[model samples]
Target: MAALSISLSAQNVTGLQGEAKNNLLRLTWVDSVDARGPVYIYRSVSPFEPGTDLSILGRLIKVPYGVQSYIDEVEFPGTWYYFVAASDTEGQRFELPLPPDNSIGIEILESSDRLAVSPAAPPAEIAHGGEPGVNSLSAAVEGDSVIVTFRAEDRGRAVVLYRSARPLKQARDLVGAVIVQPDIASPFIDYPVPGIPYYYAVIFEDDLTRGTAALYPGRNATVEAVEVPQGSDGVGLSSSASIRSLPLPMISLAAAVPGMNAFDETPSPVELSPEASKALEDLEPVQRKSSLAKSPRAFSQDLEAPGGGEEYALYSIMQDFFLKKDWDGCRNALAGYLGLPRSSASEARARFYLGQCYYFLGQPRESLFEFLSAQPAYPDESAEWIQASLAALVK
Candidate 1:
């Protein structure tokens, strides 16, 4: 016999959170029949949108013939809309009637603080003591040696410069050049190499008066390079190409947000072996990037045992990845652990990690999938965190 998918009521989907409340999204539904199935509660930033286009956002399994209310705790504080549906083991889907006109309610609330957004590209400006117009800058390339110079104001601090072989958007490729200090109206020079085109920008910095013992750049802008001299030699004002000065547009920030202090700066009083120091140095910046890139490899490298013998190793690796903000890697490693044919304890641990990974990756829907799958494998006490992560995903 073909299985019957659970159809739900309109009231089950209506009367939900209508504002951003920093609370879980409450969902209720009535199963048509007593069927053991995976009931999914889907949410969207927009109303009545399909699962894929709009983020699936959240997912949950409705218990058979029980009080079918699920609290999704993963929603951010914003105007959010949602929909609900259920599916049977046969993969047959039955969608609940959507709210009137297909829009879920929202109660707006506040979200917690997070990491700062990365810095953007800089613009062009006049050098200190120069005329009111923008400075004239150019790129001179000569056989593996490229000299880039620009005239900009000495804005009371060192002139911070950035050079990129590619366009300005690829921040990973942007390397920090020397900072030309304030009160200096000198031409800035950087070597980028010949034949390779490049983009450049300079920023002027000022002491951060708001924070104690801190310095901040007052303004940043980009300028057009006026000259690109091919095979230009060193020494003397080699003025071959005529250049023009153009002021880079200024960007604005809405508000001053608190900056994050890096954990690596937490000085450890203990001495370190030469090998440990080298290893730590190697893992510093590259740790985060490598974790993101090699999540699968890290996952495969973890060892598991017949009992909980391998739990420590797994936890250690996951902890390392989590600290590095390699959430996807954590999720993949957990998923790999879950796929292994192992005891229930190991599976529970894996599932817990899976939930954490999903939460950090901003995929509450998939995170929900992992949480519910692992819920039964864990004890009641341990499952609390599992449920918490699940609840977070649905909201």
Candidate 2:
């Protein structure tokens, strides 16, 4: 008899099972104990019946024979069937089904499902950046300046501070107001002439750019203006712009009759003085033609008074510009008025209006200077303007 040979192979895969969750299909199988090579995993829209071509398309993966489970990421919701066939060291595939094993099917949805055990979780999150805006804002009068104190959370960026005669309510209040400090820090010293009260507000420069910050009274802003002492430097103020950069008005109540408070005196309007008309005519050729050429009657204002000479006419011109809120034109008209002969009353009015022009123009230093010079004529009124100019200079 010729010699006969017989070789043994590994058992087929068993216990094939699947669990679907969150668009993921997890397949599990019992690795054949005798298996030595990789196993072939097949998937299809239909169940795997016996005699189905084991070599046909539908092979999902070839897992090592020792591995027992795999998680398949599903892109769409639907039904799927799976089969796991074990292999021997000879690389030959075993049967797809041998018992209640090696074959399974299930339906999946876009939503998630949980089993007795779950998958590993995702990574944790981390935070970045500091808090925005200002806080703890308060003010006190120190020397000739009001020391404004506050806590700010700035990430090495700039901030803007605003001063207002009225309580600050919105960003719109910033209109026509000088930026007391383009960049700011706490304990800012402000030079405010004693008289009018003032409110302050600070905003982060970054928030202003990002449009996220807001003005909140008593939080980042002063709910009330600080009561500055009767004595202040009356010379200059402080801010991120520097306390010294802004000079407050130095008041001089010179050449005034005793107790003749100008603040209470409301003079009646008069016709434009001939000197004022002549002065307007003398304006440089480049001055605004139609607006500047108007007659005194055409440019009447509340503060006009009867007077004579070039100074009086110049004063009239200043009044016209001032009433129009044309600070630039008013300031220009003042240069001519300042150059003329100084009259006790005429000079007082000029100084007062000049200060008004500078204050409106955002030049606190010059505004304060003129206000102080006019103190003698418009005692009470000049004091108020001076105090306001001083507050504007505050850091």
What is each predicted model's overall lDDT from 0 to 1? 0.43, 0.63
What is the number of residue pairs that collide in model 1?
Answer: 33
lDDT by residue for model 2 over 139-242, one digit each (tens)?
87775578888887653777677777777655445544556776777778777656668888887755543334556554577765776665344543333334
Model 2: how far residue 40 lies from native, Å: 86
Instruction: State residue 335's C-alpha deviation in candidate 2, in Å.
Output: 32
Give the count of colliding residue pairs in each prediction. 33, 9
- Which pairs clash in the backbone of model 2? 144-232, 144-233, 235-248, 237-243, 238-243, 238-395, 239-395, 249-368, 276-313
Kindly report which residue stretches of model 2 are placed more than 4 angstroms away from their true locations once superposed. 1-132, 236-395
TM-score for each predicted model, relative to the true structure: 0.24, 0.28
Candidate topping TM-score: 2
- Model 1 local distance difference test score: 0.43
